[model samples]
Target: MSAPPDQGHVLVWQEPVQEAWIDYNGHLSEPYYVLVFGHATDNVMDAVGIGPDYREANDASLYTVEAHVRYLDEVSAGADLEVRSTVVGATGKLLWIWHEMWVDGRLRATEEILGVHVVGGGSAPFPDDIAARARELLVDPPEEASGRIRPLRRA
Candidate 1:
């Protein structure tokens, strides 16, 4: 139920695919994956002690400034999905988060985000403890972390 004491939390968000999330084409819609991955990012922020209390107390919160989502496969309504998040790294005010959405035992989508810490309406450094821990867990960003989504062109 929890990661070993030596390691930080293994961030995960699991939920059932909602019918309302399906689009007219009858598959999970592009925006819905963003919604689900957003939830996962919330969980990650909370686990790192940047949750509601932190915001209310410090007036600091993480804002996603950039995001890249890859729709790798299709998911249907009622399918079970899980999102796993990794802390890629952190600069003074920015934290990079990576998420993988899985369904039916396969990777369905991925989202990589640039998260900035804001305090009193301006970008600020992440707390020392959070930065240290996140840096420790940081690995090289995933291979897919590069590139933008674009229409496939003829090779």
Candidate 2:
């Protein structure tokens, strides 16, 4: 899908909490949370016009260099999950994104991601059109995207 003309957050992906994804604790497993977030990232890539076809055509793609996820709540099986994503920023070869995962209208998780555009096995500038579209969708990062895991200080 092409980038939406609107310049704000977008609902990029949705899926149900599958039975197989449940853990012994009876909630969505930790890895599954990352899996869903990854799917949302892929959708965001598609929106910005760098999906599989683009990769195959140009031998270039966005490679996630770093990610930070906060799993805030439990998700039960069968719950419908949706991810809202924002293009926090983008440059010639780097993209920053924030995603919030929602279940039953409640915020369940958030992930901050940094991806680098790669061509021929090294970082490279994004194609002009793709960069333009990503810029059009850019928005300020949310409060949750502090880019740090909460500090751990114990007495």
Q: What TM-score against the true fold does each predicted structure earn?
A: 0.86, 0.88
Candidate 2 lDDT, 16-106, residue by residue in tens: 8889999999999999999988888888888889999999998988899889989899999888888888788787888887898888889
lDDT of 1 by residue, 43-89 (tens): 88877778889889998899998898889999998898888887876
Pick by lDDT: which candidate is best?
2
Model 1 / residue 61 / CA error / Å: 0.4
Off by over 4 Å in 1: 1-9, 147-155
Cα lDDT for residue 116, candidate 2: 90
Please give the TM-score that candidate 2 achieves against the real structure: 0.88
Task: Find the 10 residues in a row with the least total lDDT in model 1.
Answer: 146-155
Q: Could you report the Cα RMSD, in angstroms, for every candidate shown?
A: 6.5, 6.1
lDDT (CA) per prediction: 0.78, 0.81
Clashes of each: 0, 0
